[model samples]
Target: MNLTAPARRARRAALLVPALLGAAVVAFLAQRPLGGHRAGWNGWVGTVNGIVFLAAAALPVAVLAVWALARRRRAAGAEPGWARRSALAEVGTLYGTAPWVWMILLPGVDPGGPRRRVNLVPLHDVAEIVAAGPPATAAAQIVGNMLVFAALGFLLPVRFAAFASVWRVLALGAACSVLVEAAQYALRLDRVSSVDDVLLNAGGAALAALAARRWWRRA
Candidate 1:
């Protein structure tokens, strides 16, 4: 079923306006310091919670900006569908990926107090997480690791023909994970840089690519 141009624009506006409104509300609320104890806005904003909150608040606006730019391109005679998909894929990938990466890179409070850790053995971290008590924590850890690259996997193929293959996404995810792990180790971030993390990240990317296969195949 094909939508007329006006119908499409109306549909887009319906979605976009609500999203922009929600983002504005979030941004407004985020200005207030958490727990209501004013530790100065900047101080609160430096914490992990603050960082995540700010990122979340900014994401919708960023996507909206990208979408408007895509519309401009379409007005200049670019293919409308291509412009829309490209904008969504590009902004979605970056916005979805960056926050996780930022969280991963944040230095541990006692980074200097402990030696940097590395787990070269495959599956070691996974095994430990599973065996560790508190199923919720374990699940969160596993899911978080997967999500770190999920957006990239799901969107890359949609935007670029070169990344359409699941194998290629898997390899790229693993390579990117390796660089992140290397960064953690080199920077003495007091985090365990593990092979299992690389495995999980890659696996997650591959799975996400599979989920998006129908769309990319059409592309």
Candidate 2:
């Protein structure tokens, strides 16, 4: 049966609600726990308190921005759906992904040690980390790397037509990962730049994009 525009929109929104929730759950599972034994490892990614405060502070600004955009669209006799969604997605994208970027940019402490490390061979570092590191540390590193760009992957297609395809999301994630890795190397942040990071990050982006495939903006 054919559905009217509003009905179709509502149905799509209904589907999106669950997909978004699943994305949140997946992201949550990929991170270090918020409290308990490992809580002190609260590096940038683990800094739940700071990230929550930032997100909370940004919410009102996003809401007001969306309201203003909707008012402009209504003044121009246009449907506010696109305007509202665009505004929300734009704000959400920045708000959700900024913490990851901040985390990546934070310098590791190594006052008396070598400044930088690099691993060019694909899968080499990944295998080593998995084998040599504690199980919990290895899991946290792998999952954290994957989730670095997962929010970008999940939200980009919903906001922009160009990112609707899985490959685009993959490429975007890889490129962004390269930038972050490069920065780490250049700044001598005592971090290892690894090919495995690019691989897992791109994989995460692809997986997240797939989750939002139904809601992707069409050309």
Candidate 3:
């Protein structure tokens, strides 16, 4: 029998978003090192830059996941709407910023790493040029971060013009960054809270919001 509207939407998220996100993850891993100066393996796209690119690319998947699941939740079935909760979890709260969490590699302390009161290094304070690279790398990382959230903002189901303002979303995003940094610092988990990350993240959000604005207008 044909299901209800909610069922179709839930199925859509489960089918479409996951398929897209899975493909992306596969492509990203296939393009390993995703950053820089890495030798190619099996002709896959290897480089640190890939990492930066993947970080941003994941944004669409996250958005789709949230919307799809949110839609699914609106259509409940057995199991207390497990489908909806699952979708909510996939996109809600910390999805956009998870990449940064992974980047920090705070699994534990490095005995040789420097001790810091907080990891909050101001975004501008971070040198655009590191021993391994130039501003492009730094810029990429920042862009990725913002795009992640901006895509999130777009998919967040908040379709109102005023509520969807870039300034508001960016502000909310920056506050989120601050809360994350504070948590890291307060826990003394050895994660440095750099103010620079906050700046880059906010900038990323703004840029994404701008992009979203354009796309929205077009749509």
lDDT per prediction? 0.84, 0.77, 0.57
Candidates in order, TM-scores: namely 0.85, 0.70, 0.52
Q: What is the C-alpha lDDT profile of model 3 across 20-96, one tens digit per residue?
A: 66757765664555333344441222233444455556667667776676666667553535455546534644565
Tell me the tens digit of each residue's lDDT in model 2 across 1-219.
Answer: 999999987996797667556645554554434544455555324465545544544555665676687678778877667777766677667766777777776667762366678899999988988999899999998988888888889889998999999999999999999988898888787778888989998899889999989878899
Candidate 1 regions off by >4 Å?
Answer: 17-46, 217-219
Reference-based TM-score, model 3: 0.52
Q: Which of the two, 2 or 3, has more lDDT?
A: 2
Those runs of model 2 whose alpha carbons end farther than 4 Å from true positions after fitting are: 1-53, 74-77, 111-114, 133-137
Model 1's TM-score against the true structure: 0.85
Q: Go through the candidates in order and give the clash count of each.
A: 0, 0, 25
Model 1, C-alpha of 17: deviation from truth (Å): 5.0
Q: Answer with 1 or 2, whichever has the higher TM-score.
A: 1
- Writing each residue's lDDT as its tens digit, candidate 1 over 1-219 gives 999989988998898889778766775566565654565574455566666667768866787678797898799898987887888888889888987888888877667555978899988888889898689999999999999999999999998989999999999999999999999898888888999999988999999998999878343
**Residue pairs with backbone overlap in model 2:** none
